[model samples]
Target: MKKNSESKAGTSRRDFIKAGTAAAAGFMVVPRHVLGGAGFVAPSDKLVIAGIGVGGKGESDLKSFHDSGKAEIAYLCDVDDRRAAGSVQRFPKAKYYKDFREMLDKEHKHIDAVSVSGPDHNHAIHALPAMQLGKHVYVQKPLTHDVYEARVLTEAAKKYKVVTQMGNQGASGDGVRIMREWFDAGLIGDVHTIYTWTDRPVWPQGIQWPAQKAEVPKELDWDLWLGTAPYKDYVDKLVPFNWRGWWDYGTGALGDMGCHIMEAPFSILGLQYVKDVQASVGTVYVDEFKRGYFPESCPPSSYAVLTFPKTDKTPGDVKIHWMDGGIQPERPEELGPNEVFGDGGNGILFVGTKGKMMAGCYAENPRLLPTSLTEQHKLPVKYERVPGGASGHYAQWVEACIAGHGKKEVSSPFSIAGPLTEALLMANLAIRGSDLRIDNRYPGRNLKLIWDNQNMKVVNFDEVNQFVKREYRQGWELPTV
Candidate 1:
């Protein structure tokens, strides 16, 4: 393998860096801070962005980029035309393609950055190539389908020297910053416990894959949609939305909301990879007569407790409890009977030695327990707040990419996002371990899934290690980087 810095061959990483350095001239002419409006940018300063998976959250991500005014949607790619229609109409001038390879091969020179909003299983494959080509990348939450992929992405960002961000907008929210301030000021003493809950899996989970396969939609490329996952027959209501429940495509509820909820604790407490995990999933019944355990799909509800190694901010190991599928911890007595818990269906709470603090999903509306303390303890903010908070996340990346890697800070760069994602995926290992059945028993349920971060595997329950890295389908593979 050639050294990353040596530019011996054509388009070496070094060459790419030089090209990017030269491109930085477009942004240096006038700084974004001096630019007056949110959607106003000189033509010379625009960052050409290519979007992969242009539908639903993907569509909205592209819209936010364009709204920043610094990003011009130069190219669009998605496996399904039906999903890409809205974005295609919105950015009529952008060249369109059904495959990301074609778009990157033909338009790499034009695209300064890439925004990836494909399914969880497809994130790594979609983002890696763009980064290898030296394009800044913004990937959707959870970062990848598995822990190994997350680690690969984390290292790739450093090796390739690309500006990278995860699509967890809440990471840029003021509430998280304020939480960090309170924690730093010792308002909340050594955080020992945390609780994050969400009501998700609204589609389907804890069940078996549909036995009846449906005809593949005409506008969708079924093969491409499978991307890195193993091939499976198409099923009704699986395209676009309900894929979250299936392990083949999505990371289940944790993938859907873990980034939004667990992020607060991870950032504020300086949490790293999980040390071990224990989990119990809600049971399903078949015809109300027998208990059912479906290994192929995520459970309808799960409660996982992950232990993280001690950090600079913690007195000892941090215990984080994650509840999903409407299951939540007992309400804290400090909260009034009328006061809402976790924005009704979702929330994050920190239990510290001095007091307790809580916030809703996205870490929005954070407050100290006893309610009175929130108003009583106002600490000076040390960390600068992200402009526009969550809404500013898009512009933050756009500006950072223009400023070049190492020049600016992103809210959820892969460095942070990778560990955060691994923590959640580790929890997933426990969840998946609990469901594995032998002849007639589920032995994995009794195991405490110990994590070996160095090797990226579970030391106690070896079977669960399968989830850490998954095999991609033929003709598609993870980027060498």
Candidate 2:
């Protein structure tokens, strides 16, 4: 009774190949009998899932998986019972818990996958254990809270031989795929620079910081929500969406939207890692002690410049400029007056030697410059539909899971996404006043000002390396790579 043969009865040829691959990789390939004479079990075949931090983003992620119809929601876990109540109601059949570890321990055998949509700090804790147990994972973007954790999760996904997908849904969009094709086809010649901007005006930028003595919300589990992050008082301004502007719970403007706006360039250009990053932060509008809860001292605004060294596969060099909190880079005059710019919170502008292309957030509805560029330089008709929608993204991950393909099979697997995330995370570091230079040639070089990723520490700058790996609260240490 070979596992592959037993599972191949009614499975698609592709799925059969996938299952065999998973077995080869040493993942547990359980073959159960199908009740119906249908000959094959559905991919969902007894798949049970757990949801961690089921609140705003977590709720949305749960719905996506539920709609897939490929898995049963078995557990809803959130530190805040109030936040998890709605999700519990939605999936009344599922058990509920506050600590993910407890859920994993009690229901370990019953769970097949986990959706980690917690705050940036807790993303790793929820996803890592599941991957260790060979459970598939679908974590939201800016995948990990820190650069080191991003690399850790990527490695663990491989070590555990489990299916993994990051929740940057735009990576699966048709428009985004077109951007990749256009770049690969040389429409965007020798990509030297890219610009992404966001106008996240939330949380009342430039206002006086709230006092630290404010009473914590009764319905919110502040301690549990703070999981791996350092302890801080409960403040109304830090709850819900305001967390995005704060350093403790979120990654400010860049991390908040980098995965969305930066996905196009990251996917299209095959960006490796940051070479160097510097920033010009704004003046603080509020008192430092009053706003100590957040990362930045300024009025929630900054501009940062990032450089990427050329790889043998990539051309000359590439520079990415990020503008956040209503800042926009000075558009080059070469783009022309008629060219459209992104109006919403996010946009990506690509300037190539041959022509230019611009797209809205998530690379939606991209248009070539000069309008005529579209007609003159059209992508192959066959490649037109390659990138589709978010549903396709989820579907791709599920298919890979059922087939046993590792995370690398997906477009934005952690291997590719990890470095892109590192680059973006560096931007956050730069904005935080770290004087660090990235050396892609060899990571983690100890040069006083240079970062060496290979060594996993900053050259001559222990402070910078310390920044790379944050201090987790007791019992929340991230696994070292």
Candidate 3:
């Protein structure tokens, strides 16, 4: 947290670490800083991190960063003190602020990086300023609430020259690396089809917004919590969770789980910016003889077909079939009926000319068709594995940022994460468009949206394009950079 300038003449913790690591062989004693206890500081290469939305997963994220042994939890920011209570107690020495703007304004210089585990809607707002200030950022998966925001964050990372990572730990997993090596080895020659499914929306979806409003809690700043989204009356059970099902807040199932499940094919095949997408969403009824279209709420279940332009690793166009809400593709003939497919609740499968392969959530437990080939196949490792695999994800970003951008490789940097998130958001566009009632008919359900990636618009469906970049409310504005 020293005032290390971003220039050759300046001595940063990055430089400090590089010097120590280089001379490590000759060192006989453990560094004093490394052995320092809680709230340790100075004379070390420990990265200083300020966390936004430091609650629940946010708390765990900071803990993981500290567990890296090279990071210090320097600050915590969250709108809901109730949710942030645990992290506040754990990192009591770290400064605490209710509004991120205040913390960033007063302490930006003291922090080396920022981690965002806020709602999807506020991701871009929380992450952009830190990057603009030249601090590294680690935001949660499905990087932003909208496709345009994802693209903006992607460009900003490069513009500001900061290390960036999206929290899809699977992207850093050995399973994904194994699958990539297998594909490179031609074990699943020329993948043409893919299926990624999840049994999610464990919270509420396909329901009407509550008519009754609840009084805002004493410890929560409802306005700050609703950053960028339109003003809505405070409702019970919406905060901390259940926000995922609403359009104004969360991106529903696809936004929640797509990045984790779909990342395998994307990484292996180099898929980017989906060209066309179509979807079918399950219906939710209000009562008997009353089939209602609840556009405000995400459909309980849905299936979407996304087509990606062929990459050098593929034979032809690639179509990824995405299913959620327990809907799954028919089992492959090679697998036994009793055997679980994709850990029972979630999975991803790649169908290729020579064979097929599949993996569970986070691309874990990758196996070739017939289950017998999973262990028998002999393939040379083409890529390096992340030390500690998925669990090492937070540490990877911590080290990469401490080493400065481009000094160390991170699996899900925004350059890679942006497009991955954008594709899934585009799928969300199709999902939301499904219930659109125009001319007394639902056209979105039958339409195949042709995406204009350059413009960030759905060229064919003008109505759905509004979602590409949602209108911000609550006196907040999106970042200009």
TM-score of every prediction relative to native: 0.91, 0.82, 0.91
Q: Write model 2 residue lDDT over 271-322, tens digit each, in one string.
A: 7877677676554424645422233322467788788888653677788889
The 0-to-1 C-alpha lDDT of every candidate, in the order given, reads 0.85, 0.68, 0.86
TM-score of 2: 0.82
What is the lDDT, from 0 to 100, of the residue 14 in candidate 2? 25
Which numbered prediction scores highest in lDDT against the true structure? 3
**Candidate 1 on 1-481: residue-level lDDT in tens?**
0011211112333333333323211111122223334553435577788999999999999999999987888899999999999999999999999877667655665567899998899998888867776678999997999999999999988887888999999999999999999998888788999999999979899888889999998999998788778888889999889989999888899989999999999999899989899999998999779898688999999999999989988879999999999999999999999999879999999999988899999999999998878998877889999999999999999989888778889999999999999999999989989998889889898678888889888988787888888877765666456
Give the alpha carbon lDDT tens digit for every residue of 60-150 in model 3.
Answer: 9999999999999989999999999999899989989987866765675567899999999999988986776667899997799999999
Quality of model 1 by C-alpha lDDT: 0.85
Off by over 4 Å in 2: 1-46, 204-209, 212-214, 286-299, 334-339, 381-388, 434-449, 460-462
**Backbone clashes, candidate 3:** 0
Worst 10 residues of 1 by lDDT: 1-10
lDDT for model 2, please: 0.68
Worst 10 residues of 3 by lDDT: 23-32
